[model samples]
Target: MSGIGVLREGPLHAAVKDLLARPGDVTEVKYGRYVIDLVRADGELVEVQTGGFSPLGPKLDALLDEHRMRIVHPVPAQRRIIRVDANGEVLSSRRSPLKGEVWDVFDRLVSFPSLLAHPNLTVEVLLCAEDHIRAPEAGRSRSGRRRRDPGERRLTEVVGSEVLASPADCAALLPDALRAEPFTTRELATAVGCRMILAQRIAYCLRGMEVLTDAGKRGRAPLHVIAA
Candidate 1:
């Protein structure tokens, strides 16, 4: 783990790290008690997290006070499922119907929403396509069927990206109406045209970033207003 992280990570994580790294960036350097993914020549810290952000709380707390930190998160906008045989030959390939949206980052952000309060912290969401590789294995599923679990995820292409570095940046994700008016999570959901759960996460992050303020309650739901 002390060596280059790319060497130990999966195909997709390694690829994304390589894509985000610039010349002169040091990969997998130790800082304090944490093993950071990389440190830029400019002394900035970059972490490429391929999954949940929950585990990053300690790292952010330990580093954000002294160093500029950038978190790189990949959201699979599209996925191609590839079934490979024992010989590693492609058995089949198909595009999944489920699509990923940039807003989906909030799902993971829900855990450390308040971390955005740090001026030195920045979250960069990568919208990309990936290949999901799976191979048959001798096992049983929870329901007693043959095991068919998700395997590796390999980066195919980066489609786009968005950066949330400040309150204004996060505000831009909300609908104009919700951005300016006091609203509940349910109202935010309808206004943004997203589900209530997503709206709740969006609201949670906004409040943590100080972009929104407590406005008492409307019915059983807590209402929030944009910070002036």
Candidate 2:
């Protein structure tokens, strides 16, 4: 509601943009042939990206050379499922059992792993609680029953944040146990309490940032060692 741009953006994106707005910040302004979400009075660029980092890759490549940019990506730490009818009446509400962590950013960062080494870039993981709204779809399915489609996410409260400003910050995401020894992705997974895929992404990003390098192999799995 802070700017006319809110009318076009999704509820969650607009909410976070307004939350980050300062007194002299410009919202939804066009600069250097791209429409940025917000720009501070001192000319700092703020981008609130709620999806994959792939699409933002070119924009960063285009602007990072001349400006300081902060990319804000929100991870919902807690979610409340809200079901509503076609008439916009709330039907039921429940809490989701799944929780999100700061490490989830690696899932998106894989699109541009080396960007972390850029001196002018900062990636902030914003942790928040939000409403995951669902509404009935227009038509019936094979069983003649209506299906519920996910709607926009509505922000409830911001809980915390993690700032990844350098390659060292990326390396710190690994547990201490993995720091001193060469390890495989499987071992990294166990150390971080995450799935093999997530662990692989973390390693991929770290290696791209020059924080880790190959150190031969442990059996068939390739081994990685902390860079000296």
Candidate 3:
């Protein structure tokens, strides 16, 4: 054990937190206004965020003022959608056709573009297998939309991890095959065979991290290139 030993675990959040904690480390402790997820051996506070980053802005701001902090955000590389009835009986199960990539973290990073610049803040991106639990819905949701929340996300296992400790780390997400020339979002999207929106988000984070520089624009799209 590291710090205090596993204090407790239940939901996916706690389970992931427990797994990330150094053996014997404290699990949950109230510090200032936030209930920190784990306190490591060297005193770095670790928070496992499996949700959006918007809500964490204030929490991170408060903690980083006095302590070194790490945000462990997991991106599900493989997901299984398991639909169950209200009683928790499995009704249907299927592997989601969509696969997650490292760039997917940009979806959440868009919420806090400046957080990465903080000296005390580090983000550990974990690629993992997840189980998405949902309940059977009658028809359309109250929003009258086609998509609905997955209800709960349970992490089954970790695949790999990438640490973004500096602006250079952002380049790790880029493919080695990417040309060393200036590229627009459209070109990047076409090269990766991904949606333009995702490419835009990736570009946004790269620019924010100073890993990519704005090379002006082409037509109506912005151009970006790896910083020298």
TM accuracy, model 2: 0.91
For residues 79-166, what per-residue lDDT tens digits would candidate 1 score against the true structure?
9988888899998899998778778888888898877767999999999999999985548868899877679999999999999987
Error of 1 at 71 (Å): 0.5
Clashing pairs in 3: 1-23, 2-23, 2-24, 3-24, 3-25, 4-24, 4-25, 5-24
Against the reference, the lDDT scores of all candidates come to 0.85, 0.89, 0.80
lDDT, candidate 1, at 205: 85
Q: Find the candidate with the highest lDDT and give its number.
A: 2
Q: Give the TM-score of candidate 3.
A: 0.87
lDDT of 2 at 128: 92
Model 2 poorest ten-residue lDDT run: 1-10
> What is candidate 2's lDDT per residue for 1-228, written digit by digit as tens?
135445678889989998999999988887667788999889999999988989898899899989999999999999998888878899989999888889899999999899888899999999999999987445888999876686879899999999999999988877899988899999988988888999999889889999999999988999999998
* Per-model TM values vs. the true structure: 0.86, 0.91, 0.87
Candidate 2, overall lDDT? Answer: 0.89
Residue 17 lDDT in model 2?
90
lDDT of 1: 0.85
Which scores better on TM-score, 1 or 3? 3
